[model samples]
Target: MSAHAINDRRHGQTTLAHFFFAFVRGPCKLLSSGAWGERCRLAKFGGECIHSDFHICEDAGRMGNHVASELPKSCDVENLWLCERASVVMAKFSVLLFLREQWTVLVVTGTNVGLGFEAAVHLAKLKPKRLLLTTRDEAKCKQAKQDVEQCSVTNNIEAWPLELGSFDSVRKFADRIESEGFPINAFIANASIATFTYAKTQDGWETTLQVNYLSTALLSILMLPHLIKSTTASDTARLVIVASDAHFRANKLKGVANWPSILGKLNDEEYCTASVMKNRYELSKLLQVMFVREPASRLPNPTPVSVTSINPGFCHSRLTRSVESNLVMKLMVHVGKALLARTTEMGSRALMHPAVEPSERDRHGRYMSCVEVAEESDYALSEEGKEISRRLWEETIEILAKIDPRVNQIISQHLLAR
Candidate 1:
């Protein structure tokens, strides 16, 4: 584009922004409450009256370092600084944020260890605008940051504290990201836990389900707006869930036989007993695959983001070490390692392959195994399973919204009916 055209475009955007802010501020012109019991007489003079204290105009007024010693007679002005009142100092720090150039913000959860750590190291080499590496422990994250920085000096890696075991922690992390207003260039939901003892998070859900599926889904929804806006017409943003082919291995779920209505019962102690320990992990992955399908289906053609699940193919990670207490299971895992386990670096490639490269738009919801677009289980595609997936998505949204109100806002803002 020519410089003239570029200038024209910026001018048009600025004009439209001014008109938009004017429309918004028009109805917000109300009486500003004075000190304590006192009130402005602007309303008494038949001037515009705004009852709300959290006016965007007022917030925008405090934009620069410039200050005004007294109130301006009218809101109209060439510069916002000209209308400042009572030595108001515009907040320079906050205003500077708007002036900074946009950058790609990629998030990799559980980055303090294993596959997540390797992926963060790989992403760091790309020199992303900001790489948010998340782990439950602060000390581990501090170490993880040092390790990732070793890959590249200018890696804008920030270790964010996230504890998937607690609902409040997950909500807090998601809220902090939203408040920062970073565009989600890519979000990798890589945190998951496998437990043989059938533990539960503070939210009361089964530990495996909460860490692998529930919290990941909640974070995905919370980040949807940022993801959508960052996505371009030609190349959309990426949403990757580290799912496994173990999903197909899940069999004869007890309470889940009732499905949607009994979804909450998966956390029941009896339901998650030793007999079903490994099966619960498989079920969580299956639920994740189902989740991948629902959101892609809900989106319009040539979707703005890809929601994908991948199988790293029995990778050599500590995920399976949870069953070490069972001698037989431990022996199987030990033998399976030598026979088929991919190195963590190789497994990390499975995530990076789909993430960094562009694929056909129709591939948005597809399952991937070993860097190839592969088929999900028949049950995941069957009519009955589709119904279960839909119900699960709705139920998941309801559960997440109850945890944090922001989930609702993010979903409605980014997702439109096909």
Candidate 2:
């Protein structure tokens, strides 16, 4: 009769249900190899098991630890963990399905192809009030809009133009969204690039730094007012940023210690070489994590808009196609993909999971991996990381304020002051 006793009884029931479904529906299959390194594509798709979609692994590592502690006498541990990972993701999606409803409005970027497109399709199925998909190319955006239309009954999906490489374009897009007067329930900053080539945006910043970090920070800040307006007593708006696990591999940059002018060091031509480009994307993602974390910390408790970054893991996408100029790098990437890549569909689930799932609102400013809240890189959590995050936040606001005066107004009026 006690609360603890009742909870334990329910957990026992759920376990029995999972085992029964696993056995009767079909054996959980390991469709591919590399359980951890690559993540074996588990054969639990198409709802093969009824309860497969109901169980979300709160602690992503819990199942792996469980499998390790109680490995079957003659079983392959890696394959077993693969099954666990597959089940966890599938279960997580089902939870989303259960919570599905007509969302007020949601926006996704880089939807011409890959994860963004796939995520748009999944979100469309929810039949939101409006689903805006943006891409840099008009023709491709139109085609993507048509493709998404065919997959779902949501007729409100619209394709818009957005070029992250230019701050003007980013500001214009935000202007249009704000002018529309519709409260944005969720904004997914999913567009990004990874290339060995060095270049600068029209804003005179490194291409990766501008597109992946600067422009993204700008748009998120510009849109904060709308996101906050959308929040109410019953629901809070969400800002879901598609970051990456590669942030863990990010090399500490010399520029970060430069304080207010850190962007200057990154923009220096010498620092943008093909060699330094090896970790360019990773570094940008680290900056993004820091950017999101600082703002999340500043927002008042019971925050109106919840900001979170997600690591969809490595999936097959055009994000790095521009690196074709480097044969050796291309070959290395090819092998890495072949060995360990999740489908865009799987990756998209990670992208949309936090956006639609109400439970994830509490994870403001946290990093999500495999659909669960996970710790960020050691450097990102160190005292040094804190200092860099502080400087990055100030610099971002400064630069954005120069581009659009609205940035300062939004931060001062919408977000908590330092």
Candidate 3:
């Protein structure tokens, strides 16, 4: 049979048995060519095609040698067109197979750099159907997309600019996604801001709290409806907050027993105090965990969404660059991190693992370190903490409403629609 005739017959069978038989027979035709040169060219095409199709075909060796035997050495299949056609066919088959099986979506924040970037890279390999990455900088988003593209070409991933500090930006971003009709299966509130000096967002809120906590809260609220709508019985939706060990330190320093009230009044002295500076970043992370835990605990019976918080451990990334830059501070930070510091890839494992791994029994609302579920501080798990988180949620909604009424209305409508 002609190669074309065999390919036509094999088109209907995407199963492994048929694919291997057809692939081998197609290339084995060239084996009859006595010329050594012709045989060599055929072998090249067979090898290249097999390499490209490895992910699609389950049995590696079965299809490989079959293609090698048929190709003639004289007929070099090095033409880009042939290569492109092979890739497209493989991709189409792979995608169809993937779609037939259950799939999930993951939304990763601050994917442009550091821990967020590392997490996105790892998650892509797990084969989520869709991965959405958000960053405040468009240029950074483009770079992130490029980085992911290099790693796993089959995964469908997208990047968008999302400035968490601005209510306007967050609302606009959410609106765009809603209008486009994208579903969210999981969300990671991983973006955060910290500085040795203080700064305010465009909306006049403190930069650290605004970016690290408020904006993330707003985005989650905005996206909650889609998350709920997209969830299925076969799958459990999740919200993973990338929190920190600094949370424990924050609880110790501030007599501030509550989460929201801690943000109530920050005098210059409180803001600049040595303890405050060191713990402010940690406090923001703690608030995030508490904030997620509050709503997560309140879902109706048989909740559709499960929430958890995790600390990626100390990593050598841009987040810690400030401490690494100064001589004395760098030494101190290095010494501290060495005891527990993980590389970026290692640090991101916990974050990525939680998103992909199935939930453990009775593991919701727990804190995670090194991907193993751990306990949050007693203060964070107390009734006072829950109350404080609830109050903080209310206060946050009020503040955002004042900043952008449209966002408040949109979120309210989303909740109501649910």
Residue 6 in model 3: shift from native, Å?
65
Q: Residue-wise lDDT of candidate 3 within 196-279, one digit each (tens)?
A: 656667777777778888888777777777777776775567778888755654543244454335555442445546656666
Residue 181 deviation, candidate 2, in Å?
Answer: 0.2
Q: Candidate 2: lDDT of 2?
A: 14
Clashing pairs in 2: none
Looking at candidate 3, the ten consecutive residues that score lowest on lDDT are: 32-41
Candidate 3 residue runs with Cα over 4 Å from true position:
1-102, 252-261, 266-274, 382-384, 404-418
| RMSD to true structure for each model, in Å | 21.4, 10.6, 16.5
The candidate, 2 or 3, that scores higher on TM-score is 2
Query: Candidate 2, residues 251-303: lDDT per residue as tens digits?
Result: 77665665447777777898677678878988899899999998898888889
The better-scoring model by TM-score among 1 and 2 is: 2
The TM-score values for the models, in the order shown, are 0.72, 0.79, 0.69
Global CA lDDT of candidate 2, please? 0.72
In candidate 2, how many Å is residue 66 off? 22
C-alpha lDDT score of every prediction, in listed order: 0.66, 0.72, 0.61
